[model samples]
Target: MKKTKLALALTSAVFASSAMATNGTNMIGIGAQSMAMGGTGVAAYFGAENLLANPALIGKSQGTELIFGGTIFAPDVSSEHNLGEPASPGEPVGKDSSDANLFVVPSAAFNSRINENMVYGIGMFGTSGMGVDYQDNGQMFRAQSALQILRFAPALAFHNETAGIGFSPIIQYGALDIHYDGSETQYGTFGLEDAGHGMAQGLGFGYSIGGYYDAAPGLTLAASYTSGIEMEYKGQLSSASQPFAEFGMIPEAFDDKLEQPAEMKVGASFDMGSLTFTADARKIMWSEAKGYKDFGWQDQDVFSIGAKYSTKSYWLAAGYNTGDNPIKEQDGTTTEGATINFFNNTFFPATTESHITVGGGMAISKKATIEGAFVYAPEVKTRVGVSGIGDDYPIAGAASGDYSETKHSQTAATMMIRYNFD
Candidate 1:
């Protein structure tokens, strides 16, 4: 039995390193389920370890079953400029705003009980995804026209309990890409077009250890902590206008490495007759991370919580979370007035908090379970210097206009199908 379990763990870790690497729900949790539950799996089933939320939550269940699912994600944004000075909402010269775009994602998981007390499973889920299109139209219409940012992860887990405790170690894989166009500040608005240009890309890796403890009958508490990974990316750099010019190629000196923030995670679940209540808290150590390499960046803290209720026929859950921004203006960047700049923030953002989620599960048959979930996460708003598109800026061109922040939001849904094989 020990040999078989050991093999499973090694195989799971190996698979994880080759596939995905993602972090935080929104730099707060991992995904919708954890996000719906205040950011961690406190009351979740110890089934497949596919989702990266909590590696310890995946375990074997009686019956041979297959679970397939998907999520549709939508993001929105809004920005207000020249604040403190007071500006009209209809006035276009001072502030501008737009939505990122809608995203459709899919997920799958398979779980099986090795015996009455052992379980193992694997799943494929989205760790993170980002997109923007502020420049689809003409560049002159806005101060800055651009698009950029991406970070994603996929993982696996294991669980077993005869009465003592359950343990799981998760391995993660990650990759991020960023791009953006340069914008300049004019009379009262940020200027747009290929004024400046640049691109940055990176690969990251990391993992965590987690476990479950049964303090009472049908009641257990789970805890897991993760250390972030760092990735230094290199790409082409140039002004929006002079792409093939002197600075067309990204300079080695300007190339940079950024670290994922470390976080402490805690969660628990209580079974009450036919109901289950869950809660979770997490503290992301953004402070441990470094600012952007050439442009400069700083990390921020994140917190979250969630609850769930279950019955013989079905189950429902919900949660919320908040965090600090990682974007900061550096003292001396290449651009004169612009102290420092950021090209891509998929690995970093100024507004990294505030999310709400809801989801449920239903029995499809005596041996199968079907589930679905939805989340509403509005974009965050912040200020930097003079000109700012929303936070979802493009991948290239670090210094846009100066002194301004951006806003962003997210809305998404997920569905899962599972079969139990005893």
Candidate 2:
């Protein structure tokens, strides 16, 4: 179709590569209520989203419950190129912005109590993913990319009077595409048209385990663990796309191995009268994962706290969440800096660090409820210093400086509808 439409599709592909449905690259929370509460459902109860959080929560749910909803995500991304101070009067500074800004993600879950001690359920949701599509500015850094992950999980939970445990085998589907201009790269060995541009898709499997225990009156302790998934994408690049293609070996097929990271979370919730408070701590092993580590990512720790006030007809919640930036700063082109490998900083910057969330739920009827939440993460910026090319090197369209930087931010809103079967 149109150029922007094609770019949008490819951008979505890039979004799938990261597990960033909510938190940093992993969704901070699954359902609207959980998101509103700063993704604090780990130790608390959050209806259907528990399948993605703690499978044991399915057994804690009341009668048959179903939730369906989606999020409207919007992100702002920009980049700057720092080419030392102006040697001449009124020299221009380089800057650019991403063209793709809005994306829609969907989610759903169902839980049914088979007996007093058992619960069975199914959930289909988007785990995490994000990307940027920078329009052509200078020839060196123009790139477009994105990735998204969809998960299907069938879960089971068992519970008694004091504790409950649950398990779910996860099936995930992901796709990715990247486009960058390679000809102008200062590091010529980092070929683009050859190894950088193209599309790929893959399937993988993983599992999650979790449980919860009632500690005292109106208080509970909970924990969950998710395993990593390994996937290999079979990709293709066209002969007309970039570098001249050699008709060898399937002509267009290539493979990329991507691994989604594992995570552990612990949390607690206490309720007194009409107010409930929750706190959670989570650790994501990004550096141990395949794709992220390959791109120079570091492990991250996330912390969140939230409070909810409940009345007979409505409930309101607010919270804050923060984590470390996954995108490591680009060191100078020293031997140490050269060891830190990163690709497409302008097109795939994952830099947002903290969020403020607020949300509320309205009861429509005895069987149905609707919830909505808003999340905001302010701007984050980083400067990257590249090796190779230096100043004044563009000898008749040859090469220039390798210094660059980027600034990025995000805003998202989500809505969900829940139905109760009695």
lDDT of each: 0.45, 0.70
Residue by residue across 88-158, what tens digits does model 2's lDDT show?
54442456677767888899999999999999999999877766664365342455566778899999999
Model 1 stretches astray by more than 4 angstroms: 1-35, 49-51, 63-65, 80-95, 115-118, 136-178, 183-204, 236-252, 256-259, 290-301, 326-352, 378-380, 384-405
lDDT of 1 by residue, 338-392 (tens): 2222222211233445667777788888877877767666655554553332222
Model 2 alpha-carbon miss at residue 328, Å: 2.3
Among these predictions, the greatest TM-score belongs to 2
lDDT of 2 at 125: 90
- The worst-scoring run of ten residues by lDDT in candidate 1 lies at 10-19
Count of clashes in candidate 1: 58
* Candidate 2: Cα lDDT at 94: 51
